[model samples]
Target: MTPPVYTTGQVVVNSGSPISFTATDASGGNRTAVFTGLTLNAGPNTIRVRGSSNSSNTTPFFQNYITVARASSTSVVSGTTTTPPTQTTISSPYTNSAVLAGGFAEGSLSDLLAMAPFVPSTNQFGSWAYGNSAKTVTNDTITIGWHKGLGGSLTILKDGSGPNLINNNASITTTYQGQTRRENGRQSDWAGYGTPFGYNQNGGGDPYTAYSPILNAQQRDSGIGYNWVAGGSISQDTSRILHYETRTINWDGGLRQVTYFKTQPMQWELRGVVDSTYRHVFYWLKGREVKVMFIIQTFRTDGQQKFRGRLQEGPFMYITAPHYRYFVYTGTNPTGETGTTGLTQINLSSPCEGAGTAGCPNQNDTGNWTSTGNWIGALDESNNGVFIVTPYNSNFVGKQFQSRSGDENSNASAYITAGPHLQNIDLPGTNFLASASYYVGSLTSFRTWYNSAGIVKMPFSFSFTPGKTNGWWSENVSGKLNSDNRYEINIGGNGGQGRFYSPEGSWMANTIDTIYVRGRFYGASSMTMNLQWKRPGETEIQIAQFNNKTFTVQGDGVERTYAVRMNGVTNWSGMIAFVKLTNPYPYGSFTGNEKFIPTYIGKTNPN
Candidate 1:
């Protein structure tokens, strides 16, 4: 601080101080003038300000809140107050609730949303549709959605603010993309009128409407074919495969359609959608080495007709080619349900060894499980939680894993494991038919199985409790994914035990210390369970624990999905999965083959 009245604007030099200096002002170039006095060394001194405005460009003054800006950059450097960063937020155009509450508020929101509208999009490749012009999950991410059709015609499409849609029938998916265009390899050519002496390649006399001109009632050899390794888009769409096509035309029918026409069996393509979204069934691949295969069903959404001035060959069903990808559910209950934690379905009725002709996965159990055995489904998740299943195993303890062609894609499989509680005991153990009720998806959330009446032992239960938090038998076994790509739960037989209780007659509620059980499981893994379950299907592994406790659980069927990818490359073949265990630190668990690496892969181009 200085000792004199200093003014930063134009002022007469009547400065009073021990050492004074007069700063001139032009009011044009040097508007504000400064009068300094007693300017000794760099020491704190008292200074007074004269209220005045800097009349010249040379002088500048600031009052109240100050905002300092970078000298070189256009961004603000510092400000007197804090303001949150400006970000682009993604929100639905109109909340369903808001729309329901229509009023002035709705009118305002509608006006704001007027800038955006719902647009059709497609992803024959990915699972998520293009963002809705009126909605977006993120700049790149989208809420999974589907476009349904009237009656049975479904043309899968996505919608977003920017209005983007694509189909994967064209390129090399997400691979070989160095210099390739997304639209390069997606076109189809059906030889018809005007080509080759006005002859029709279609076996059907006249290109019919209800019938596709490309193929007659009977599937015959084709003159046109296309093949390529599936990737990002292919793998992502594993959960859903959509096929729909109309004309991309405007006011006057702007024409721009691709066509392929050659004599020798040649390959053609159409359009391309974005990459796919891959996920594991609550628990997907667990085998030492896993491989997935898929197929695409090409059919016409519109009438299959051929004429000089008509649309032909369109809306092909881009499916997962055989040998697609597999997701593996590997996490335990990230939630609180111990029973639901790492809960997976174990084939009780049949081991994953002899898949059905329609492609039902063989049971993966290590024991002698056959067509008669049942799936050891578990839902030991302490706090109740929901787990996903496939081809819902109706109480019919007979049918094995069925191909989800009706409700799920046939190219994928899932692996789930729950309840590390049940363990092995002696050959002679507690024998009872005590089963717990579990909730089923889409159906009854709870299903119960009672013991066969007329047993010798009285209804008196002895839930033998082991002092350990986690049980035994299952402890050292280290549940693992067998080569067959199924869970191997090892349990011994003998005088088994459980939390001895007398719930009905003489009871020991949460007693018997820690119950040693061989109960069933329908446990669910976390989202990290790298499984590739078809988006829409259900399966169950109803396991009967030795101690009369059968944990029968099921995953409800979700929407079906379709996708295909090449294993070893971007998910189709060369993939790395684990024999993951989900029991907390010690209690007891199986670590699955501790010394095995994924070595076996399905052979592509199989002879």
Candidate 2:
């Protein structure tokens, strides 16, 4: 039977032959079409009916049910039926004792303290306890305390009993061997000298408002307040446990506690809300390294808004036993230019601020300077230092560094200020999100990890528009997009090149080991291709001074993939802002119109 127009129907008999059936168009109600005189097999004769659309239109059709009956009996049999299996619950991986210890029950505080001193193979993940009725988490390197009496601000101590790293207001009197000696200690209360992350909505025109867990009377009057009023819970897994805290300031901003584990770093997820703007700060602490990330989100704006904010993680003071007197600036100038000597050093024993002497110039000397090199190291006489690496921040406008010399009376302090600096950023109708990351650790250890184990993925895509370069420019070469959407470059001259300059800033050079290039080489038997890059602070692009940079590719006119092994390149250290591919063959190697089509370029870590 022929199928109906715009509708389809099919039928098949078991073990014999297949047949088609026509379905009549029925309107408003249900209708049935029957077939007779069909032969049946012994046990179970399978019959199938299928319905489909005959036209390309996407209209749908439905079938309520299908029925089949025996010739002798009127009883119908509807397909096959089977019983479902039983459901069972799976047990949780976390132990009952671990859940209780990681929670906040009646006796959970004592249980949590007992599990605090966890020691792994590498380092000791110290302990957590109540100090002055406040919660404090301590490790071998530092102790961080928070809550009520501390003005709801985090107070950090070096090596548990050492001087305060967040502030230099510690003073105490001790008697030893009948001699009264006054010693420096943490402050009794962190009122004015509090390490709080806050923001100014009016572009620093008004005092900043801050959010804390529990604010004191003085803190409340001074723009510090708490939105959480109990109902915080803790949960645990095999590796780590999380403490969830709820808050409601100008908006609903939640807080989270650090996961206590030996292998993983302790991370704190804190949030703040002022007016319609919200900020989320994540702190990851392990040993001497402290990684901080700030996510700024603004909502309910008129059109565009201007604001100033900071992640005040430190006013880190230098210890007296080994005074940190040397300051090294490993960065570029305001215009992203590096001087003849990349490293700038100055002695911090002499106080300097806002562009001091020529030799001891600061960020103010460069007029709202931004560091493309992204790191600063402060060292003692023995080269034992603390380094702060900003890595790559696309949104950072103006960055400032301030340091004070140490004296017999006070310890030396160094801090950094990273913000947009009063720029009118375009806020798209009530929503905006921007972020920055900071890595702090010992200079020697940070360099080792930043190069090897701390690598991250860096992915970028290229465009094939004719005039729109999209941060990619051609020198001595003309490029166009072919019918297949591949960017084809015509070598106009001998030294033709195509380069991609990073539009945001410099990319972390150590993060990328292999650069995958997919394209074709045409019009010649073979050609020599060289991969080159510009390091951070470099104004001129140059060929990479390594043997691995030069590679020979066959011009078979077929598209192929190639991997540029930058790991073997010796000059691949430091941040990279520009990368290029050049045809380094002498003249007369091929026709000047020889085509080079590069379809894709990606940088990734294979390991």
Task: Tell me, by lDDT, which candidate is best.
Answer: 2
Q: After superposition, how far is residue 340 of candidate 1 from its true place, in Å?
A: 4.4
lDDT of 1 by residue, 237-335 (tens): 111122222222221122221110001111111111111111100000111100111111111122222201111111112211210111112232112
Root-mean-square deviation of each candidate, in angstroms?
Answer: 32.5, 26.6
lDDT of 2 by residue, 1-607 (tens): 1121121111223322222233343242322434465665433333433343446423223221221223233433222211111112312111222111001111112232333222112221112221223355554665554422222223343444655444432233332112232222222110111112122322333232223222222222233211110101000001111121222112112222242221111012111111222222233355555433322222222221221112222212223323333333345332233332345453333334533457754432111222444444444465544444543322122122333444223323443323221111112111111222223334455455545434222234332222122223344344433554344566434434433232223555677787776667876677877777765434442443442276767788787777888884777876565566765534445556577776556673222
Candidate 1 accuracy as TM-score: 0.16
Worst 10 residues of 2 by lDDT: 229-238
TM-scores for all candidates? 0.16, 0.34
lDDT of 1 at 351: 24
Which is the leading candidate under TM-score?
2
Off by over 4 Å in 2: 1-135, 145-160, 168-274, 300-374, 394-403, 406-412, 417-425, 428-441, 457-535, 538-575, 578-607
